[model samples]
Target: MTGAVESPFWTFVKQSVKSLFIVAFALSATSYTDDVVGSFEGLETGLSAALNTSTATTPKTTYEALDQSLGKGLDLIKICTENADAAGFNIGTAIGWLIAAAVIAFGTTLVTVIGGAVLIVSKFALAVMFAVGPLFIMLLLFPITARLFDSWFSQVLNFTLTIVILAVVMAMATTAYDAFIASVDLNSNSGESPMWAAVEIGALTGVLVWIILQISHMATGLAGGMSMAAMGIRHLMSPVTGGLSAARTAGNIINPVSTRRDLESGMMASGTRFDHMIAGNTVINPAYRQHVMQNIGKNWGWQKGGSVKN
Candidate 1:
C-alpha cells in the first residue's frame, strides 16, 4: 500500500525540498562564520592602532629630546677640541697620541648616540609585536603589558643615563688631558728628551683610559642601584596598580565613549602650549598659569605690574 502511493512528481518535489533546506543551512552557516571573522579582524585592527598611538606619544618624545641633547653635547665637544690648540708640541709621537685620544672620544659618543637611537626604535617595535601578534595574545590573558612596558622603559632610561654619564666623564678626561699636555715642556731646546715625551704620552693615555673605565663602572653601579630601587617601589605598588586597573575597566564599561573622549582631551591639553615672544622673553599660555601658580604657591610675590611685593 505504501509503495503504491509513490508518484514521480511528488518524489521529485520531496528531493528538491531537501536540497533547498541543505543549501539554506550552508548559506546561514557561511554568513555567521564571515561575521565572526570580520568582528575579530576589526578588534585586532583597533587594538593595533591604539597601542601604536600610545607608543608614539610616550617614548618617541623622550628619544627626540635625548637626540637633541646629544647633538648639543657634540657641538660643545667640537668647540672644546678646536680650542685645545697644541702650540708647543714638535714630537710626532706626542701629537699622534693626542689625535688618537680625540678620535676615541668622538667615536665613543657616536656609538652611544646611535645605540640609543636604535633602542628607541625598538620600543615601537616591541609595542606593535605585543599588541598585534597572536603569539603575544597571552599577554592579554592577564594583561601583563603594563608591567612589561614599565620595565622596558626603565631600562631604556638607565641606558640613556649611562650615556650621559659617559659623556660627562669623557669631557672631563679631555679637559684633563689638555691641561696635562699644556703643562708639559715640549720645546726642542728644553731639557725633555723625545724618549721621555713618548713615555709621558703613553702614561697619560693609559691613565685616561683607566679613568674612563672606572667612571663607566661607577655609572653602571648607580644605574643598577636605581633599577633595584624602582623594582622595589613597583612591587610595593602592585596592589594599588591592580585596584586602579579594575576601577579603570569598570569606568570604561559604564561610559566608554565619554571616558575615551575625556582621556584624549586631557592628553591633548597636557601637550598644548602657546608661546608669545615679548621683548625676547617668552610668555607661556595662560591655560598653564594655574599649574604654575600652584607650584610656586607662597613664593609667587609678584604684583600685576611686574613689581616685586615687599
Candidate 2:
C-alpha cells in the first residue's frame, strides 16, 4: 500500500517538470522571432534615410533641393548623344580627373580658408581638422557648381549626393544667417531709408549667388572629369563579353545595392522622432547636445569665428 502511493506521487512530479520546460521553450521562440523582425526593419529604414524620397510637387526637401532643381530645370530640353547613366558617369569621372590632377592649387586655397578656425587651437586634432576638412568640403561641395546650368549636369555628372548634402546644410543655416543679418542692420542702420536698405540687401544677395555659381561650376566640372576617368579605365580593361560581369561584380562589392521600399520605413521613423520631440514626450539631453555643440563650434569656430570667414 505505501509503495503504490509513493509511485503515483513521483509520476505526477515528473509530468509537472516536463510541462514547465515546454512552456518556457515556446515563450523563448516567440521572443526570438520578434527580435529578428525588429532588426530587419531597423536596417531597411536606415538605408532610405540616407538617400531621400518625397511625394510633394516641388521636390526640394534639402539644400540639394535648390541645386538639383536648378540643374534639372535647365537640362529639361537637352538631348544626350548617349544613354543617361553613361553620360552621367563619364562626365563625373572627367571632372574628378581634372580636379584630382590640379588638386594642389585650389586644394590649398580651400585648406587655408577653412583652416583658419583650427589654427587658434594649434593642437593635433585641430591641425588634422584644419587640413582634412577642407579637402573633404572641396571634393564634396564642389559638384554643386553644375547646378548653375541644369540638373542634367549633376545627373549626367552623378553629383546628386553632394547636391543633396549641400541642400541640408543650407536648410540648417538659412534661418540663423538671415536672423543675424537682420539684427546687424537693426543695430547699425544709418538714417538711410528702409527701401535703400532693401535694395542693398538684394544686391548683396545677387553677388553672393554669383560667387557661389562660379565656385559650383568649377567644382562640378572637376568632379565629373574624375568620374569619367574611372569609368574609362574600367571600360578599357574588360573585353566586351567579360567586361560587364567584371564591372557588375566590382559595383556589387564597392557600392552594395538596396531597394527603395525599405528606405521609406526609415524616413517614417525619423519623422516620428521629430514628432515625439514636438510633443514633449521625448526630451533633448542637454549634456549630449552641449557636447555636439562644442564639436560644431570647434568645427565652425567659437566666438572669434568672424575673422575666419573671409
Best by lDDT: 1
Question: In model 1, what is the error at residue 282, expressed in angstroms?
Answer: 62
How many pairs of residues collide in model 1? Answer: 0
Model 2, 62-136: lDDT tens per residue? 423333333321221121112222236566543433332233223223322322222222233323432332233
Question: How do the predictions measure up, each by TM-score?
Answer: 0.32, 0.23
Query: Deviation in angstroms for 133 in model 2?
Result: 33
After superposition, the stretches of candidate 2 with alpha carbons farther than 4 Å from their true spots are 1-60, 63-155, 158-162, 165-182, 185-192, 232-310
Best by TM-score: 1
Clashes of 2: 35
lDDT per prediction? 0.43, 0.35
> How many residue pairs clash in each candidate at the backbone level?
0, 35
Candidate 1 per-residue C-alpha lDDT over 1-310 given as tens digits, one digit per residue, 9 for 90 to 100: 4675567543444445544533443345464235523443444345333433342322223344345334533543343334234423544644543454455445435544544544454454434433333322222223345354344434433444444444444444444445645665544335444345445545654554555455435645665666544554245445755676687678657634311111213322221111122211122435445444545566566565665688
